[model samples]
Target chain A: MKPRVALKYLGLTPFAIYVVIFLAIPTILAVGTGLFTADGSFTTENLLGLFAPTVLGTFLSSFWVSAVTAIVGAIIGALVCYAMLGTRTEGALRSIVDSASSVLAQFGGVMLAFAFIAAIGNQGLITVWLQDAFGVNIFENGVWLYQVPGLLPVYLYFQVPLMVITFMPALQGLKPQWAEANATLGGTQLSYWVRIAIPVLAPSFLGSLLLLFANAFSSYATAAALISQGAQIVPLQIRSALVSETVLGRENMAGALALGMVVVMVVVMWGYSALQTRTSRWQR
Target chain B: MTKQTVAQRIGAEPGRITRWVILVVVGLVFAIPIVSMIEFSLSSNNGHGYTLDHWTGLLSPESARTYRTLFQGIGNSFLLAAVTVAIVLVVLLPTMILVHIQFPRLRRVLEFICIIPITVPAIVLVVGLAPVYGIVVRVFGGSIWTLAFAYGITVLPYAYRAIQANLDAVPVITLSEAARSLGASWPVILWRVLLPNLRRGVLAAAFISVAVVLGEFTIASLLNRVNLQTALLQAGQSDPWVAVIFALLALAFAFVLLLIIGRLGSVSRNRSAQ
Candidate 1:
């Protein structure tokens, strides 16, 4: 019986070994890369690079971008969910928004950045059209579409939809019985939401907010495609460190930068999971 | 009871006008860029006036040279998507099924392992992968297809969730027990009994793998690979319109795929509950 049970776990070996080699080891090496020199001698010098102004600036911008998008997206997406709450389960609008949000949420990257470029880049469609019709230079402020602020609109494209996708379940999980109960106590429509739904949804909302923050923070291809000139975010910082020739013997900067990113992601995801547990409590 | 009692089932249908107002406003925000992409792609040049030349240029002789790399990237991405999907179906699928029926205790650990990819961003993963690829190159050749190994990890959190949701919905244990009572072999049971039942989740996992692989850029680009995104970026440098056109096309393809996925999600949940 013991041998048979051991044999049952044979199926896990392929996946276990795969992640260990590709994921687990690489994660360890990624964090550890900053602590060693080129000749493989252990040192802590390269990690100080994480504190350098440029990296800090990138992290600052990353936080600002993520926080803004997460907040804005959470608001818009929560409103979208509130809008969707009225529609029947099998309604066309509900499913369209459901599927559309799913698609938009996953579909951001180079393609999305290009779509925005075609819309608002220096010679973009809207840029050209607006110039021709109204004689207004939308890019008079230095082609913001290609800069850090530019990521907001593009990031929101995915962020809002992702908010809708993740937060909708929490919205839908609102039991009908609660509303009826609130009404039996002579509570108004506004009162029910103020008292019951808001409190119950606070954790889920915060949880989704954290998720969106991590998402926007870690997103690379969209930012990489847009901000072609400099490292304006954490992911882009890692990119430049990976490719630039002028790291000045600091090969571990990219490692340190990646380590920084991993730390943020770990903290944010940990909070998200904790909130998720709290959220799921009411869900069941 | 005020007028609220009549609509209490869904809790006050929120004023239909209000609902439409919010949805339409948000919908248009999402739609504007897509419309611009189409309009931009249709334009002949950066100047005024429009022509089909840009669209027709795909068949032109010069475009063949211009887009040679783009074609190679698309091909490589498709191959990567196929291999990645194969990995999910073959390795992840069986392990999940086995864990569900045989070793239920490992489910949480397996879930954690699968989800670990989400916490480590692709950029950070690439930082770690640079060295692993060294070993990967030594063991497997430096072919672009091997990049699927990393993609397999990236797509894990997605594929696992899709399959596991279905696994939870299905009565895998009951079916396997009955099959065993009928004297069926484990291989036969998995092949004949389980795969058919998992069609929705399995197909969803495969579609998700394809969608993710097509959009992947960070790993392939950092690792010096040629895939759809890297190819698109390069092509955009020379001919931006064609690049936008292809981006629009990829976007449309993904939209349709996810629409189906969305349907699959509800269909499975409803069927299993009943």
Candidate 2:
């Protein structure tokens, strides 16, 4: 590199400093603060709190929601992509879905929760309509829609769109030549998919699955908006540990919860990246 | 004998009906909430009959007092959005261009740093930020706008991808080198030449950053600050109608913003191809 080029690297310093101070330090403290006492001495007491039944239950609930949403979102979104495969890649329909997916993926948080509330909350539009037309009640079993189970449809709302956005490129990368070659060999449609397509797509599909899991696992706003009471999941647990609904500041318990969440995200992202590399080889 | 017939169907393309059916069903899952929002917002306060007071209430003078918290939160979110976008355009954008132009080897490191924020969830990040913010309050005086510092970091992955994609597509180094050979100084080359070409990516990144900032709640709420989402969450608890109304507007704003980003991408693609 020339001196001029070396000088150019100085342009990165501000961004580097900004990221280190805001992102890196907070992340380090998130995990490190969990392993020590408030007096700054080392202790595993906070980590041990993670194994307590209530904390364990919160982790299980978060995992369950993330896993379920990831699986269902992957399947449905892949189907959407599959349906879209025949459409012209640059056609209006493709652009519409692409744009819609990006928007809907961003359209989580309070807006999404409010949308769902208006749709199916107690005395919601669908709630009243369903009762009037079909005598059916979704909340007949005691408002599961307001609890962890309720997070299912809401999570799927964003997850499926995100899946479509992430998975569609891989779907598009499936060349026509492979199908043509499979056809020339007299492979049936099912056989072609099972043999040629499924194997090739497996890495991308699984990669996308992990991405969805991490997304859902890390999601906060929708869960925060929907469930106003109780720490039913890890993020909310972190919230409750950090602050009650009105009050601010709490003990080191939130740090342990965050450390666990970080561990999960890191593992998932690692798998996603490794699988992504496999998918990329095919992209070329 | 039947080999050719089997081969003919190997593409596994679903029937047109299947495609339309899948699209419609999923589209309805998305549309229903939006429609319900509109309907619910137009409904009487009792949730019985239809009315437009909630929508029009936004501009009512009386609402300034009644909905002060929600409006304040909205204003703070807008301010945060602008500041966060500034942080991206000012800090991240130049670093990316520098990496692309001068130190190609650092591209990977730049990407790694930007993407790390995605892996660390905001909720988790807040736990770490709680103590850090105590120090932040000492320096920044506990203003809601300080939340944008965290918002800037949280949006790194999204911002990086948008700008990096454009940086990759455009020949940043070639363009800059050409400008340099023509006696243009580095800053002049950057400001005059590189910025114009990178407009689409910069716009998309800015818009996406705004979207993310406006939706930010966990950090602001936990940090004892109020932004749009926190205020909406509070309003939803007391006055559900007003909350839903504001939520609908926020959704519309984000929807339009993202659609423009998508258009910006393809429009540039077409122009370049032509």
Candidate 3:
């Protein structure tokens, strides 16, 4: 190669090596292990195991949890974003909310779960207060705090803020001119949103929703902390397979489950990128 | 603007109240749990009244073993964050600037590679890193600090985006050309000229890396390494209130870090505006 060309390639060497060691090779092993047997010969047994009733059930439940959180989070978050948009962009409230959203979005995992337990767990302050003050038992129905039913709200703590962060830029990208133009043409507020605003924001909104789904789907720490036992979601299932001493030879099963998660997230990310590009075109 | 007044005449002002109301409601929804955590952490174990025992216990010598792991995890997480941020800046800033300057066509490829981790969940990344961890342990020995290498990869997507935004904002090519013509070497230009201009982005990236490393649980826990979050988890299993205290502390730490970054960002913006 020419000296200049060689220099350019040399610039890439450190990053390339880092990615290869930490990302590329490990990913290869993850997928590769799933295709081989205990003897190391290639087989599809682990992949097939992903479809067994228990494994499939975990995937389905995980999907349900992700789907519910995504939809609920998107609606609430979009409303929050819309409210913030009505304020001056550089105002204190807007900046505070924006920064808070950024922090809260990353503020998941064990601490988040602990926060929920402290709030609404069986002995949580709110639960105790409600019982003592109003004679209402928060757990009279059952102890849902540690189950999938309870995870929905806990997940939303981060999810709503995350949605706000991702969706705000798109919301800001919307030009006031579009709405003004609609008004000038004798369109009503309802008509403007129905015909123009919703259609314009659809791709970005859908993209953000998919991102939320994938976010909740792959999340493990909060779920792991809350559930404590059994594989309620795909991540927990992977955790069990990896950590459970009794599950002696299930490392490949963990790979298979990991593969399943990758496939779902890959699809979600593809759609997110496609929508992002579409939104950017108009904004630019 | 004219149309905005016309629309307001038709009563868009109602939305102003609705907006405030919605903001208040959303704010409460977000605040309740955090408030509860604080309240629970301070309350007596019997739930009859309040005390600071949990907070004090974290510091008391009686809980030395618990606090030892917690402190070690916190220290390790900070070390990892510093190292990871350094690695990100050292490796990414130059390569990104070089790519933007010399190989514009390679920008997409670089971005794609950085974003690969987004789709690869941490759980999955742990799976992939399992065998790699074996090699890493063998060569480097198993110190929780080596987790920084994995963290550097995980933080790539965010760091790259932050640095890319900074690179795009500054006239890197023009600045470098001007500096070169002034007899500055490449390292001098990068360190003295380019980096100063990219300070906001670098800080943002570092803040994100720190937040991520501090909050990271799965990789550390699964790897049997005692980082802050994992230590909190183990502590929570024994005494839940103590865990909540640590959780609140960590959250406050991240909140303060973000607030500082936010302040710096706006200060820089104001300076540039002037």
Candidate 4:
């Protein structure tokens, strides 16, 4: 390599420094701090405290809600992509819809929270219309909607689009001729879909769903905006541990919790990766 | 044969009905959020009266200060995103080339690092970085800079994966060999031959970064920075209309991003074909 080449390599310094200080160092600190006690002794208090009823409830609720969101989003997204396949309509409408889905996929967190609230809050249009026109009360006497249920619509804001994006390539990979041939063989619609369509779309379906699960599980803003106080998921709890300095004196506790969450995510994502590898065969 | 023939007869007829049903149902389901938002924004006194006070109020001089604040937040967000894209691209491009050149085994490791952030959740990241951020702020004497730091880490997965895919697509060794044979320096091969070829990935990554920055509410709000998402949240607390308008604007931002991505993808495809 010449001197100029070496000089260009030096350009890599800014990025290298930024990543170290911001990402690596801080993450290490969070784990280190959360795992150690005030007396400089290693303790599992924070990680154990993570199992407290309040924290556990939030985790369980988030798990179920996120699971539903991922599955539903993937299914719907796959169906949407399937419907769009081979359609002759090509213009602004198609592009607009595609764009809309893409935007919604990335538009989660706090913005999604606000969007859902505005759309479904107490005095929200949907809320009011449902009450006056149909005499239905979504949250009449229960804290259900605002808790885990309310998080669903917000989750969908991103989940559906994520599914659409992830599943599109998979859909395209499935040869239409296979379906045509099956149809010509006098196969029933149900059998054709169950035997052929499902098998072909299975890998994409599984991969997309897993990806969606990871997306929703790691979500913090949507839950925070929806049920700020009561339901404390891992992320919110982690944020709280950092902020409430008076109570959370042991930084190690925070670190332990952070490390635990990272571990769980790694496991989940490992499964996702395995699914992706298995589904690679479906990709044309 | 009869069973197969019977199944085929049904399959031969397109499930147009099911297709239409799925289209209408899913389309309506997806449209609900946007429709509800528009209704809320257009409603007066929180939908009690059908008036455009919320929309009209936005234009009034009284709302000017708030608009200024909102615009400032947006500006800060865009600046953060711009810086983030530049930082991420610089880091991702060279690292990608080096990994392909020297450490093929490290590819998965690097990818794991990138994807780890995705699974960590924004809240965890903010929590983990808060102490680090505080120290940096105290030492460096700046708070807004924290947003860039946080955004950079959170979006690393997106940037890395995109660039990695693109790197895999192009003939990396061929390009490097071509450069080497021509007396081109490694830097020239990396920058001129490699970086230019990685344009599509860069664009996609940039868009993801933009989306991440613009829509980043947790980290910004947690740190009490007045980014667009935080401002929107605060506005909603005071008056629901503020949240509604913010949501509309957010949708607009998302729409623009989508259009840009679509255009970029098409252009890249066209170029690749050529």
Top of the candidates by TM-score: 1
RMSD of each: 2.1, 3.0, 2.4, 4.1
- TM-scores for the candidates: 0.96, 0.95, 0.95, 0.87
Rank candidates by lDDT, best first: 1, 2, 3, 4
Pairs with backbone N, CA or C atoms under 3 Å apart (clashes), candidate 2: none
What is the total number of backbone clashes in candidate 1? 0
lDDT of 3 by residue, A1-284 (tens): 99978987898898888889998998877767778765688888788888888889999999999999999999999999888765677799988998899889988999999888888988877888799899999788789888888889999988999999889888777677777788788888787778887888899999999999999999999999899899989999888887862362444778788888888999999999999999887677
Query: Tens digit of lDDT per residue, candidate 3, span B133-238?
Result: 9999999999877899999888999888878877887888999999999999989998999989998988888887888888999899888888899989988888
Please list the residue runs of candidate 3 whose C-alpha ends up more than 4 Å from where it truly belongs after superposition.
A245-251, B1-14, B59-66, B267-274
Can you tell me the CAPRI class of model 4?
acceptable
So what's the TM-score on candidate 1? 0.96
Off by over 4 Å in 1: A1-3, A245-249, B1-13
Give one digit per residue, the lDDT tens place, for model 1 in A116-217.
988888877789889999999988878888889999999999999999989988988888778877878888888888888999999999999999999999
Predictions in order: lDDT = 0.88, 0.87, 0.85, 0.73
What lDDT is reached at residue B56 by model 4? 78
**Per-residue lDDT of candidate 4, residues B1-274 (tens digit):** 2233332345522355655777788888778777877777777673365787778788888887867767678788888888888778666667767877666787777777677677766666666677677787888687475578778888898778767767777888888898899999877887788778888888888987887788888888877788877777666677777777877887787678768867876666566668
Which window of 10 residues has the lowest lDDT sum in candidate 1 chain A? Answer: A244-253
Candidate 3 structure, TM-score to reference:
0.95
